[model samples]
Target: MPHFKLNYFDIRGFGEPSRMIFHYAGQDFEDRRWAREQWPEIKPKLVGGKFTGKFTASDTGASPWLEVDGERIYQSVAIARYLGNLFCLAGKDGMENAQIDAMIDSYKDYLNDARAFFWVKSGMGQGNLEELKTKFDEASKRFFTFLQKRIEKVGSGFIASKISWGDFFLADGIKTTMNFDEEFEKKFPKMVEYKNFIFSQPKIKEYIEKRPESVF
Candidate 1:
């Protein structure tokens, strides 16, 4: 197994899905959480590090990167998908993989809606809070409604017939959204049940119980 060191901010944001993947696979890794004040010092090293393999940092440099035996990898979904393939949580066929990718891309769109409201609530951005909230609520319903139908079509609680990386990604995303709005369970009962089922996995449940709390 590769030695993994996951670097991200103190929040769950883009990093939690990969963390959940590691724990689900019983893979030990370094979960390096950085404070906002420390990123300037930390990011320069990542961009110019003497890593073994290709380094894939963005132009501005970004968090939620992974160091695999000194080879730097970037992009949240890329890192999570790589880890998912390593852990056999990815799809078995190309079509299945495509389906999973499409689901993840759709989820990203929904997440952006949530972030619009979150930035306002956190006072990091300006907007009418109520207006953003209304937009997010509608977006949430659309995404979760599709998710519920997908779960039913697959005839499994997960996005696929068995556990897949999409399940981890979607479940973690919903968990984060729930922090912004706790009424999700009431608004989308079936989707909430799916989230509960995913989190109920022994490894995941344990990680959730011991994981640090974050506002986003």
Candidate 2:
């Protein structure tokens, strides 16, 4: 087995899903994190600065990188998928895998579009909360609606009537979206159940109950 090392900030941001996947797989990994204040120095050593392309980032050069055999693998989605294959979290067939991938892409697109307003712009950067709220609602509603139909067709599991890496994507996503509005779950009970189901895994529950808390 390949030894694993993951590098990211000391927050849930984009790293938690991979972490959750690791725990769900009952695999141990090196979880390296730095405080936000250390980003400036770290960035230059990794990407977008002095090091530039030496170490890759998610999609561009952000973080939450996975290391194997002294080689770095960038991007959280791929990391999760890799672990999924090792842990039996992958779909039974190619078609199911494609479906899961599509969901992952949809959520990532939402993040790219809303990052400015919801994260850096609105409350902090330059975007406004009002606009962020509107965008957040639109994305959340669309995802939840899509998920509802999917669950109805699949029966129980998040996709393909079984648990898969796709569950981790939405497990984190539903929680993150719910942060935008406390009552968000009230509108989609099935979605709430989905979130609850993912977190209910014994290993995942243990991790959540004992993992060090961070502000992200």
Candidate 3:
């Protein structure tokens, strides 16, 4: 097995799914984190140094990268998919892989909607609470409804009859959105059940219970 090392800031952000992947596979890897204040010193060491202008102080390097041996690989989705393949959890074959990708992409779109509202509107301190909440609800259901329909066809516990990287993505999204609105479990029971199924995995359950809580 190749030595794995994941480097990112000390927060959960995008790097978390990779961590979940590692733990799910029961693979041991380095989870390296840097303090937020240390970025001024760390930015210079990234592949593209900040002074070159190609990378910025705020830039997160191929974050949640999967460092094999000593070579650093970037891109969060690629890393997750690679890890999924390595662990034999990506999918049974090509068609299932496409299904997993579609599910993940939809989750990403759903997440982006909430992210835009929070970062662009809430961060600016201008947005109507009622209107935004309504929008958020619609966005959540639109994606969750799709997931529920698929899971209904796929059967219980695992999507597509077995675990896949898409499960990790959905699990992560559920945790994120629930923080915003806990009522999601009540609103979307099937999606909540899907989240529960992933969390119920022995390795994942252990990691979630033991892992340190961090703010994204």
Can you tell me which runs of candidate 3 are displaced by over 4 Å? 44-62, 118-128
Report clash pairs, candidate 1: none
Question: Residue 84 deviation, candidate 3, in Å?
Answer: 0.6
Q: Once model 1 is optimally superposed onto the true structure by TM-score, how far is the C-alpha of residue 51 displaced, in angstroms?
A: 15
**What is the C-alpha lDDT profile of model 1 across 97-199, one tens digit per residue?**
8888989999999987778898888788899999999999899989888888888998877887689988988988877777778787788878778889999
Question: What are the per-residue Cα lDDT tens digits for candidate 2 across 144-170?
Answer: 788778878888657666889878877
RMSD of each: 3.8, 3.2, 3.7
Candidates 2 and 3 compared: the better one by lDDT is 2
Where does model 2 exceed 4 Å of error? 45-60, 120-122, 214-216
TM-score winner between 1 and 2, please give it. Answer: 1
Q: Could you tell me which residue pairs clash in candidate 3?
A: none
Candidate 2 vs. true structure, TM-score: 0.87
Clash pairs, model 2 backbone: 120-125, 121-126, 121-127, 122-127
Give me candidate 3's TM-score against the actual structure.
Answer: 0.84
Q: Which residue window of length 10 is worst by lDDT in model 3?
A: 50-59
lDDT of each: 0.83, 0.77, 0.76
